[model samples]
Target: MAENASLLVELLTEELPPKALRQLGDAFAQGLVAELRAQGFASPDAPYTAYASPRRLAVLVKEVAAQAPDREIVVKGPSVKAGLDADGRPTPALLGFARKQGVAVEALERMQDGKHEVFAYRRSERGARLAEFLTGALEAALKRLPIPKMMRWGAGDAEFVRPVRGFVALHGEAVVPCSVLGLAAGRSTLGHRFLSTGPIELVRADDYEAVLEREGKVIASFERRLERIKQGLAAAAGDAQIAADEALYTEVTALVEWPAVYEGHFDAGFLEVPQECLMLTMRQNQKYFPLVGRDGRLLNRFLLVSNMQVDDPAEIVHGNERVLRARLSDAKFFYDQDRKQPLQSLVPQLAQVVYHNKLGSQLQRVERIEALASAIAGLLNADRSLAARAARLAKADLLTGMVGEFPELQGIMGQYYARHDGEPETVAAAIEAHYRPRFAGDALPGDAVGDSVALADKLDTLIGIWGIGLAPTGDKDPFALRRAALGVLRILVEHELPLDVVELLQAAHRQFPAGTLAEATVGEVHAFMLDRLRSYLRERGFKADEIEAVLAHQPTRIDDLVPRLEAVQRFRALPEADSLAAANKRIRNILKKAEVVERAPKAELMREAAEQALFDTLLSLGPQIENHMQDRRYTEALSTLAGARNAVDRFFDEVMVMTEDAAVRDNRLALLAALDRLMNRVADISRLAA
Candidate 1:
């Protein structure tokens, strides 16, 4: 056994990519700890802390051993029977193995390997010392980091995400003798770029963070720095809400070592532009957090996280304000120039913009979208003219200066520009909503008109992209066809629209040029959408079998999918559900094998008492199930079918349908066919069987 002590390792480097800082730190810490545990240098459950800043990556591990424990080593050789001949004399195989181990044949031990006794060499092996193994572990951990690109500094062979300036490797109160990235490990590390006076020395492995904060004027822990920034923002926000997302906060946290939040403001005139534009410039370009009033409007003031803290920070605040003014001025200029002309005038420019070489230009795609939107609007009983108008102008904003600068503002800028051209409210709203539900958990289109255009846009992309042999295959959907399919499914299922998905696909296919798409494209895309629907339903908490039950029928009208699934759930809970489902499964298997012609069950053919009784019960339940199904009362229909479980069970147990009489067998199969049809009207209950 070796003495154990805490360990610290840090890599001081140039400024890292802020967006990847957190992930880099986590990977560095976890990778080092994993290698340490694997090499027996640290315990399985050792406590550790990861420290990451813009200029450094570090980890502190507690209870790391200076050396691994010694253990026994075994090397298996020839089997006992082979190693010894009839007179128990050592054979050549055993002699060779013993010679390799540097021992005599009699020193070999015989042990059972599986069922056969084998001759083996056993010895005690010394454990490795930390100083001998630490560098290798560090190299392994660095090799596994998720660095997208590696750079070499000063023409050296060493390569890392950034130029490495220093390395720190400490065990307890002593510096470990190790080297990495062509740099020797030391106890000294630089802190803040401007605030700290000189290199900070760590006297012990445990004092890394404390000394960095107190003397070096830097916060080593990423999480602690983030919390401090959050507290400062909340205190400075007063009544205004901080209009920042987690991504912004994380990036800002990575940009600073000792974060100090400062308030800055822009001219009130910049607020005249859409708040989305202003907020995008501030957050995306400047890394600033904008403030929003209670009324959900952007305030002129914004908060910025700075690395330096001063008693009077007027210079920093004014400098940030000045920088933001230039960005806002650019946004305002784009907005002003974009509004000078109506959005419709830009539609013709889409002719030169290639959507895809296989699929026509943007102008042609817009034409297809326009026609499909009209057709979908007619199906939803929405304003067809409005849908068509919205679809025609949707891609027009792509040519605008505002949208060109901030591509995220494509649809949103279209809405503003549409309104400026005095377009109808419904048309403008539809133009924006056509791109709804862009990502998971986003909102769907607001109205039927919007839904119509959205479906058209997504359907065109899915059918067109898929028709050209670019369907999503093993996570290689460069065109995001999977997302488009999900968007279409969400619109239909969530809105409860009575549109047939296949019919919609056909309508979209018609808009394409003749002979451009394969004839089977419609059916293929429909099947793909159903696969996406299964995943979507599973995420909504439906059981796999339950989803299969509803989808087994391959229902083309998917708006009723949820209702059918809900009914199946209720049916599954019935006291007789298990036996009934088992019977249905048995029936399906029997019918699959039976060779019979179409015919109703003849009264005279049903000879057994149990068979006749089941026939009567099915007849009585037929009208009730039909009425429930017709009224869309799927739960009631399944409940009504459950009433025949006793008859079904009795028939299966007593009936023998494969008789010498062919007519009787065919008639019995027909009876079962009717029963199967009624039972599966809502869903294939057989899938629920255990």
Candidate 2:
């Protein structure tokens, strides 16, 4: 057996797509390790380090075997009865099998094959060497990489995300001979395109990362490079805060092998444009981090991550500033050109832009949203006129120059333009906030008018898109109906608004033509929203069964869903909760089997003491539970129902519900039906049963 040692593989290439660099690096490392583990060259849980930079992708896996363990081979031969003649003598068939195995018929072992005995041959086979399998493993890993598109370089048929420049494969101090993408694997690779003097040599697989960083001036690890960039930005910002997201940090890390953060500034005069516009241009176009002062306003200054590190970065700073000035100038041009006209003037132009071919134009959609927003405002007791005006202008900015340049600035530019037009403050704010909670954990609209418009907007999309039979299927939600549904649920439940989901969908449907939608669209969308609600509640840490208990009722007033789920959770902890839940489940089964009509229990039909006592208890608890339910005190109502557990258990234990007397059985079924109503007012407690 060959000794086990760490293995290293690196691929040097042209600059990779910055946005996809992290994913590519992860796929490359995991893919290689997985394939190696599958082939028995590495352990199942082998530790590996992934390295990704602008020009390289590499992985170092620990404790990889030089050769796999030897395997045993077995070949089953003819059955004993077929192999022998009537006198139990060897036949020609058995002799032919023995000749193939290079052994006499007596050397064959007899083994049971199902119900028949068979002759078999077994032998030991040598394990595969690392050098024999490394090339194939490397090729398999590369083929499995998550490269959406592959490009071919030169005249060769070899392809990758970018042109392959070099390759390195090492096991301890030895080079595992292999070839990939027309490149022969060696122990040397280029580092930091312009920083290192020449190709760096790896003496051992374990020293790859350290050697690259020390001699090649390249930080091989993506995470380490990202952290270094973050620390540099923080230190350079000093008093000001850097305006950058995780995505920006990751992209910058991918663009640099040796990251050096430098500060640059644009003319403060460009601050007249909305800070969002400036910040987006700096981050998206120039890959710079915009600085914000303690006052929460954009500063003229920004930070840039450069691949080049030098004693004096004056030219680098000047070059970046000059490029950003051109980009910011374009943003300013769009903003100024857009503000020349009031946002309302752009509404008529929306008719030229098609929202969807199945649906009407953007103008028609905006009108629907206006009417729906007004209706929702009435439901919330907010200013209907303000909501209508906000919705009317919500998509108008989509026709503006600034929005055309930056689609993400649609609602934001609308707010700025609305304010500039001297529109009502509430309406301006609503126009901007109508798109709140755009993604998960995002903030909700700040005011009632915004809430009304936001719900109206999302509900309109959910109904219209789903109405035309374009509902999401199997992760394909091009219309984003799932997102819109989740947004509506979040607003209703989070805001605790007094609106039913079905009612909102109905109102949104009405905003369209009489025959515009399918009749069942409202019910279908409600069910879909309920599914999203289940997942949403689970993410909030509610148990699956508890959520199902409350959702079993399919309550339209989702504002109280959390309270009902909480009540179910609390009820599950009670001493009698299990017994009551089990009894409820049993009672449900009896009623289902009996198929009895629902009615109030008759006092005259009660023949047993336990039955009468359970009846009296239900009557006594009815008003208390009703009052608690009316007050929306779900926990109190469930607690009150818990008091009836003893009576419920005794009734089931003492009385036979399915009796021989038809009248008695009917009466008892009615009694259980009445109890069922009270127990399930808050939630179906039976779902909580073990």
Candidate 3:
């Protein structure tokens, strides 16, 4: 056996979905590396790299040691009571223990420790060969690695994300022996399907990558494939700009075993369609890159990446051209059909389609959005008429032919269709922006109209679902309420728009049909939105509990969240705030101890000057805190909270709050309650870190 042998394996299958393959490649590499380390066979220079293609998934590791380290083994025998004889020497129990440990009674030595006599021995063995151990681990990983969706091919019932056709496993110059899902491992792998048909025998681990490359394939690393794809694309489209979508390029790279760039063209007449439509149609549907002319107009030509390097490139180009023609023709048809009717005509049809089984039809949802949008516009002092118009048509595109075919183009198609129907420009824009910030880090709407509609749409969805008792449970958020809530917060905070989410929810709750969701029982829903807000703040570098404390006291204004969060962050770093929190904790601890035997007092009968002083200070800060919060001066508000800390400490030191006098104790307790209320206004300072 080679002492420092390493292994390389390749699984060549049919074209895999790009997104699926990227995820699969990452998961396979991580799992393999962990399994190698777990078996105690790690080498300093050894690491795994994964490369994916539409036709194959490959993993390579270098300079692996041939054997794991050998180590001493210790075995413990039965207790002294079971092993010792009358003379404290060998007995039947000791003999049985020795036999179990593969050591004879004569080989065993009795050692008397503090409490009992024990028998111990050391055993040593050579580590398993790398080639053998790797084969077992590889097989285990192949079977255990999760694929989002899988298929069962041929017989033997072995399921995989995609069908497995060929597998090549090489350890140095020899093949590794392992079988997975009924397929035996070998050194033979095919390349480029039709372009290269012969079996490529991987004789050496290092030579495997070269073999695939020589056979018109780029199989060694995803980075290499990405680099080649980008360079090839740039070269194909010279001076004329052909901006490659990074997301699309990543997906295209994952979809091919051997990427061959070729140019194709469509009749320039298709460019008459809006640029968004043409681009979405080509890039999203056919995965083709559209070209631009010197003037930045959509050109007649496009670029296509193929897995196969055909002898006749023109034929492949023609085939792709035909497919794109059908797609573009379908898009043109939808565009023309949508233009036949006024965009408003579709608004009535939405009522027939159910938004949810329990929560009325789409028309009802539109009504809720309209009401919610108007309220939001009023709150933000935006163009209420424009917001109402935007909300009415926000979901109108759901009934459009193009959007029905491509659900992702819901709001986008609405904007295009609304524009064609001669609606106001702001309305059309809002129609598109209603779904802003669809994912984290995505852009929110820049216009007030879009912002208002976005708020209304998300709030309506959240309130409607929560009102109906259909709130998200655990991981199953079918309504995407969590995402909707995050989008609302992003639009409000990122745009610095003033929106009272609580009041907006209340207004929306009123618009629901007679039995819409029960408005009163959505505390969990409110809690859910606050949790999302806290998470958003935490992601932006605020501490989790700090965000929670700020959100706990007030979660209505998304605009208020920023300064409050900023204050909490700055306050968290201060030594005085930490000291105050610790001091409050001590006072609460004392109060809790007293509560065990006696009740606390209210504020009216406080005789101690410290108690009265603390109450007066708390009262004085109440209006200041409200004013600071109103002005978004949260640092000032927190400082106002700091003003009462000394008074609280003095009151705790000088006065016994839990006195036997019922009225006096009640009054003292009321003072603490008032203090708690005031402190909570700035933030739950009680929740601050020490």
Model 1 regions more than 4 Å off? 77-107, 115-119
TM-score of 3: 0.84
- Write model 1 residue lDDT over 511-564, tens digit each, in one string: 998988888999999999999999999999999999999999788998999999
Q: What local lDDT does model 1 show for residue 614?
A: 87
- lDDT of candidate 3 over 491-570, digit per residue (tens): 87888877676766677777776665774745666678777887788789988777767776666777777787788778
The per-residue C-alpha lDDT of model 3 at residue 572 equals 66
**What TM-score would you give candidate 2 relative to the actual structure?**
0.95
lDDT of candidates 1 onward, in order: 0.93, 0.91, 0.78
Candidate 1, residue 621: how far the Cα is off, in Å: 1.2
Tell me each candidate's TM-score: 0.96, 0.95, 0.84
Clashes of each: 0, 0, 13
Give me the candidate number with maximum lDDT: 1
lDDT of 2 by residue, 177-236 (tens): 889999898988887889899988889999998999999999989999999999999999
Task: List the candidate numbers ranked by TM-score, top first.
Answer: 1, 2, 3
RMSD of every candidate to native, in Å, equals 1.9, 2.6, 4.4
Worst ten in a row by lDDT for model 2: 1-10
